[model samples]
Target: MNLPFNLSPWRTKLRLRSEAKAQVTARGSSRKKAPIKLGLPIFMMIVAVLCGLIMGLGSIQYAILIVAIIVAPLVLLMQSTTLIAWLLVVSMIVAGCLQYFARVEQAHWMPFLILAVMLARVPLDAMRAAKPGERSDGVDLLGFLLIAFVVLVFASALVNKNPPMQALVGVKQYVFPLALTAAVTLAVAPREFWLKVWRSIPWFLIAQLPLCLYQYLFVEKGTSTAFGATGIAWDAVVGSFGGNPEGGGASGALALFLCFGIASNLALLRSQQISPRLAWLSNAAAMASIFLAEVKVVVIFLPLALLILNRAKVLKSAVSAAAWLLATLAFVVGLLLVYQVLHYSNKQTGSKSLSEIFEFATKAEQDTYTYNRETGELSRTGALKTWSQENIGRGRLVESLVGYGPAASKGFSSMFGKGTVARKYVFQLQTSSASTVLWDLGVVGGGLVAAIFVLAFVRSLSLAKRLAADPPLSALAESCAVAIALTGSGYLYNNASVNVSSVQLLASLAIGMVFVLTRFAKKQAFLPAVSSQVKVVKRQVFRPRIGT
Candidate 1:
């Protein structure tokens, strides 16, 4: 019925609309195919490689490092889960051995290898929006604290009186291990990697035990021992050999990290996720090794960790008084065991009894070594006393602001002989960690470090409480929290723990895992409920037939 003229007009309008749609589609496809901005990334990589060379690595080393950094992310993406999982264990084992292979200055470079591996992934993590069911990393408060810490450390080092070269050397070590937190938060993928990290803690401890045992016998044979406990009581780990344990007294102690293992094993045992027999056996063995280490700090703190971790059980209305009574009894028994071990060890080492040791610790002599013939080990006595005297005596600590500088205590080596207190104690005036902090970074820098530690401890406690209703998740948080809190021992008396190989590695790992676990817990909280029995599906990759 329509006229030819009206039909022609309708066909022309429809054809115009189809042309517009085609133009829009073409523009959209063009945008999608545009390449990522390579100009900036290529420039940045070049700058990084140059800086690596400037920092001290040779040209060959820089090339190797650059390649490793660039390739690490791709390696991570393509590698099977199991291989990635084992990297942490190997890293810590190698980290622990750093003390043997390199000097303290050289040891720190080892952690950056782990950092390079993590940094290569940052660009990828940022640009690639996470796929469903995939875990991705983002910046959090902990990362900020860490960055602030590094900056403060660097600033403090600049003001220090140590030789320019020495202070510069020390600053790098300060910055190195911090990379672990960044690495964990950014580079890690699925949850299983973290669990594997936790599992690796037990194995890491296991690997060290034989070395500790051999060192114990080495102490027994009157030979020089490696560090820490043997350096303290001479007979602390195994029993007294004829010779005294060697090294700076309180500086070399490992009580904090040994407590870490004890707390971790206890968390596993209480959660009951593992076989009952295995849990009990492993916990007992770990506790024994920790006790056998004979560090006084662990003796006190390990039981406290048990007490805090079990508060959930104790607070339950359904739980009876008998359970509470049993816990108290168990704690007392543990204390008694520690006491007996110390007593027997003291006798063989030619050290005075506990009462006499206390008398020496309590009394302040004129900054002299307190020798215990019975134990044959020299005591780093009056550490706090010396600090107090220095603070009250000259008011040096009061005036220190930016601090004398990192390793300022050792700065005196250039002016004074090596035997002076400044060189010997690694501080200008103070001997303890508090004094060291004041003498080194002063308040601005040291306060931030202190705050970081306090926040970590508080976060740990908070996370543990929040996750208490979920057993495995709760245990992971609580264990890590306990370990992180105890690492305050690094601030205990000297920089030994700070400079020591194992303590730094373990502390970095513990705090990193704590933050990582916090992220995991939040995600898991919103997930839908699933059955206890999961149906495992074998992944079958469908590659196209090349011939076809």
Candidate 2:
């Protein structure tokens, strides 16, 4: 067949080697050829702006349709979803600037923008990648449950005569990442790219430190600025999550993200997935951020998260034991310093001892969830009480079964009419994620959501063990499992998923990565030899190429 080149075996071997080298060179160059296509997103933005111009649809929100169209093709053509994932992460850090400084009306829609992309990308990728007559990425039990929850959301909205846009906005915060999980599960990317993305997360955590410090030192507590809402308590130290110029900041969310970062680095270190030095540095950054922010919840959430994700690997070696001990010591010392800061921040006229500070923190934590009957104070527990009684007490049996509607308990005032829930139970709007889910989706929907979380955590923990050889991937599954548990805990504390972009986006990504591992397992079962050969080729291609 190759007589035109050479008939001799040695000559043929030489020719084949050269061809293989050429192929490798071409493939490598192609990867470095150009960045993923941005035309799709750009074109969508143009269309959205034009729509706003023509229809007066408001520049802030051009609606979900425009963004969905843009996201589908980008995922299909891009070699990896890493860039898109980053687009979500990096944007979150500077979201405040876009919202306040730039006066971008819909800067808050960044998560939804990414969500639209993920939602569009998943179906498009699934359709494009699946072979004819091949098994589709069938909806699993969890998937079915998620779908049922979404159906309930929509059904509740329709039944209650809620505005479509209001319903969309209401449920977006809670469900956006779950939708993203579906996309990330099917979205393909190289292992190296995923690792790079994971490694960069710590740097993001570190980056928050500088801004946080500056805000803590220079920015007066009551001064309003682009960095964040200063008038609100602890708002001056809200890292990068900027808020209203009047008085708002995501100080709690910042604390949550930093605590999660600390937990992740600890988990990675315990498993030897990351080095001691890097893990220490990242944890230091996280602890420093927590100190500057002084959210008070970290002293509870961080330790709980660490305990839940604790692995047996930490006790297996002397070095691991030492690292864990040092980490614990660092956390304790950092917490003590944070308590000092918290005491000062309260503007106590009298000198307060360390014990007093501890007592204050404990009381504050209790007050957050405490319901006082005499004072009529609406804490998280109080909100839950109100929500449970809202539908059932009124004898609205059908409404109790499905809730008032989607977005029924959204915190912000809706442009759409102040419906029944908002009119009657407005105080419960800004409470915890659990109360909102219950208020909006009823018992059945909330139960389904809870089941989904439990199932995802169990499955991800199992997947982590199965992926023992791939440390980064295994760590990812473990991290996701921990994240799921933390998020469940968060439901009792705050609207972690709904209001906190970092928690929402990162948690979804981790869960999606777990499912991605599942998909990889499926692929391995079918094409084990192909993966091994591919790995070998990948190794060979990186060797020094003197000629090519």
Q: Which candidate is the best by lDDT?
A: 2
Off by over 4 Å in 1: 1-141, 160-164, 221-254, 313-349, 364-399, 410-432, 468-470, 493-497, 525-548
For residues 76-190, what per-residue lDDT tens digits would candidate 1 score against the true structure?
Answer: 5743333334445444455434433222323334455554454454466444534677765665676678788777677766544456655654454466556555555544467
lDDT of each residue in 1-548, candidate 2, tens digit only: 55666558898999999999999999998886568999768976897676667446553344444554555565456633754565556455767556544555466667566665566566676765677887676888977887887778778888888877787676676566676677666665766666666666677788888877766654534444544444334355777776544444677778777877787887677667678898888788888888778676776678666755675657678888788778877877777776666535445435456677678646755564565454333677667766666667878788778877877765454345554576674344657778777877788877987898888888888887777766777777777777777776777777765666766776677667777778765654558778888999998998787876
Cα distance off (Å), candidate 1, residue 543: 44
Output the worst ten-in-a-row residue range by lDDT, candidate 2.
226-235
Q: How far is candidate 1 from the true structure (C-alpha RMSD, Å)?
A: 16.4
lDDT of 1 at 134: 74
Model 2 residue 355 CA deviation (Å) reads 6.6
Judged by whole-model lDDT over C-alpha atoms, candidate 1 comes out at 0.54
Off by over 4 Å in 2: 1-83, 100-105, 220-232, 269-276, 313-337, 342-377, 414-420, 522-548
